[model samples]
Target: MKTSPYGAIAFRPDARRLTVSAPSGELTVWDTSDPSRPRPAGRLRTGRGIVAAAWNPSATDLLATVSNDGSGALWRLRDDSAPEGVARWAALPDRPRHVGWVAGGSWVFSMTGTGRTSVWDVGSGACVGRADLTGGRPVVGAHYRGSEVVAVTDSGWARLWRPGRRPSEWVRLTDRPVSACTWSSTMLVVGDLDGQAACFDAEFRPVHTLRVARERPRALACADDGRLVASAGDNQAVAVGRDGSVQWETYLRPPGAQSITIAGDLVALSAGRPRPTLLALATGAELAGGRS
Candidate 1:
């Protein structure tokens, strides 16, 4: 039997663990403390194919996932036992595409493919807020911090929304459609179909731009110190510095990277393969057991 490609990948910085989800709803946690030889730590099954997932910023063992079945769930990882579900909600009209946590993990939010967002209180599992974007374009990427939510669309517009407030006017980021985006406390990075990555400040002001790939970037991750890592259709992973210079590049096998995350001194990259590859963040060198 053929294996399913990884649908989502998330990194827990504090624990040096990488979580990879398959379309079959299996979530595998890999211990990456020894980056040269990662081993599976644990697993959780959602019973529904997950589209995206995010780790809680304040709760180290908490995770949120959204599924193709129009449901969303929260899970808690236990050291002595298998991971278990904490809460779940389902029967929504739209398919959720992304999930995130905010307010120090007290609340969770999910964004659907149609630009509808629902915020839920983690304690009661009750939805506290809802926001919608009426434009025809689909949301390509989104990032949530505190109470602010930023979403980028295929129309090349990025907009900010908060609970109980109207979404801000569209801010154009590029002429080409955005493919992926990631943000840190200090900066927001957006990748476009034209293979360009644009950096912006917290207030959405343009900071810099760099051509990171020859084809549309499929995944991006940014470090707190302003280092940016990206994987694109060109089958190459490139790292860029804060000064807007290419730091290093590593070629990958065909069908390139699908998701990426920065885990301390390493980059955990997932192509459409069975396991994610670990690369040295500084030089983009593949570590042991990362050979495809």
Candidate 2:
């Protein structure tokens, strides 16, 4: 399917399909049944530009997207039909960075780049709890499992919060501002624009700083097999083993690599602009599939 230049994308946990929200305000879904020849299955056009989009971990059909225009929208989508846009939610503070579903899909979490994160009940659409991040700090990102929530801040700190209890003091790590962060198994991967990707052992302590392109984008993913950490950015791409050794890297032009995802040894790297081009994860092989 077609996508805007390096627009944010998310692979469904089931891996049956992937969803991408492009800068052109089009959301496309890809059918991964034939991995080598993934094709478009659906498309929905939005009225505003998209900064980021994510799938609800608890409910696959439920997706949330944040508009760069200071608004957030939720959609309930299905196959062979138009996606239902379920009411528009505005961002009064004018900075909603990321969104996700919580409370068994009964609540929604919207975090801004300016240190304001709020949880809204799905049915009533009323905020149940709000976390004021203060100090000109932005929430790096946030993830939820059951009742627990883990959020990282721009100041290289992570916090765990939920209904009740004082928001825990920030767990400081470094002075670097985080670009992207993700968790897998028991390890949480934190990446920065300074070309450092560090792994923390649950407690957010430094286990190792995995290496890749210098000053790369936050395109780091842990292989499900726990063998390699693949990252791409800085106009280059590299994969390092868990023990911290280079496994594969692109020597030619970087494909202008934007993000990296690992499903087994096969890596999927997205590069290019306008309509981004996706390259084979391993060997930096290029696939000529035209943008939809």
Candidate 3:
């Protein structure tokens, strides 16, 4: 109900707020403190179009949204009013669609239109390093769990990049792209475009392939304690527990949900056209069903 599908979504660390970007060049935050009734707390407009949006983990009211027009702006919200511009920003030679906050630091990571990824020092807003990505439209987002940051490109490949030994030398993970990828604490679940899902280690080596639809999933979300939720274009979503149990199942039923997220025990889904709704994990039923 809060975020727009044209961009990206990042949940605040406390799970009380969410930031979403839409095709209208807008980014908004929703208050989820009371899951039974989510409310739009604040909103910000982006330049050009939003390529991606990410929430600052520790700072609940801060967010960074990147645009395809090659500019990144940091917005801070104190109340529901328009966001106040902040000090962090960047203008690159190429447009970037994916961005994330680095763990243990204020650095920001981004993937460019040319399939190039880079890290920036948020305080100084300077580029620290860069890596080449397997060419594609661009990555939608970058994820970091530990020391390694996983960047998934539009080509359906997951590239692992750690800090280079020296100045600009990055370790190339592989020439081959993984079909699909989502991460847990110690494991990564990769779904290929070929209609298969595989598990991999931190070293990017294959371990196991899982059973599910192999036809490329539309969205993927995982819980910190090791639960995986996947939804294809088919409108049905499946919750796969880490211990191998069915958590629940439900369909949005109409215009279809464009994206989903797990906050606490609730599954928040954004449906297209009609409106957005939140479902309880225990019953797979809507908590707040509102018209768009």
- Candidate No. with top lDDT: 1
**Better candidate number, 1 or 2, judged by lDDT:** 1
Ranking by TM-score: 1, 3, 2
Q: Per-residue lDDT of 193-244 in model 3, one digit per residue for the tens?
A: 5545555566656665554443555555556555554443356666665544
Q: What is the C-alpha RMSD of each candidate to the true structure, in Å?
A: 3.0, 3.8, 3.9
Query: Relative to the true structure, how large is the alpha-carbon lDDT of every model?
Result: 0.75, 0.63, 0.60
Which runs of model 1 end up more than 4 angstroms from their true locations?
A: 1-4, 288-292
Name the candidate that leads on TM-score: 1
Worst 10 residues of 1 by lDDT: 1-10
Query: Between which residue pairs do clashes occur in model 1?
Result: none
Worst lDDT run of 10 residues, candidate 3, spans 165-174
- Write model 1 residue lDDT over 1-292, tens digit each, in one string: 0012685788875637778876567778887778888888887766367767788888878888877777888988755567788988862557777777777788888887668888888998877778885354688777775687777786778877777789889888877777777777688888887778888888778999878777787777887667664554557888878776788888888766777777578887776665778888878898843443
Candidate 3 TM-score over all chains jointly: 0.80
Per-residue lDDT, model 2, residue 280, is 56
Error of 3 at 70 (Å): 1.7
Residue 121 displacement (Å), model 3: 1.2
Candidate 1 — what's its lDDT?
A: 0.75
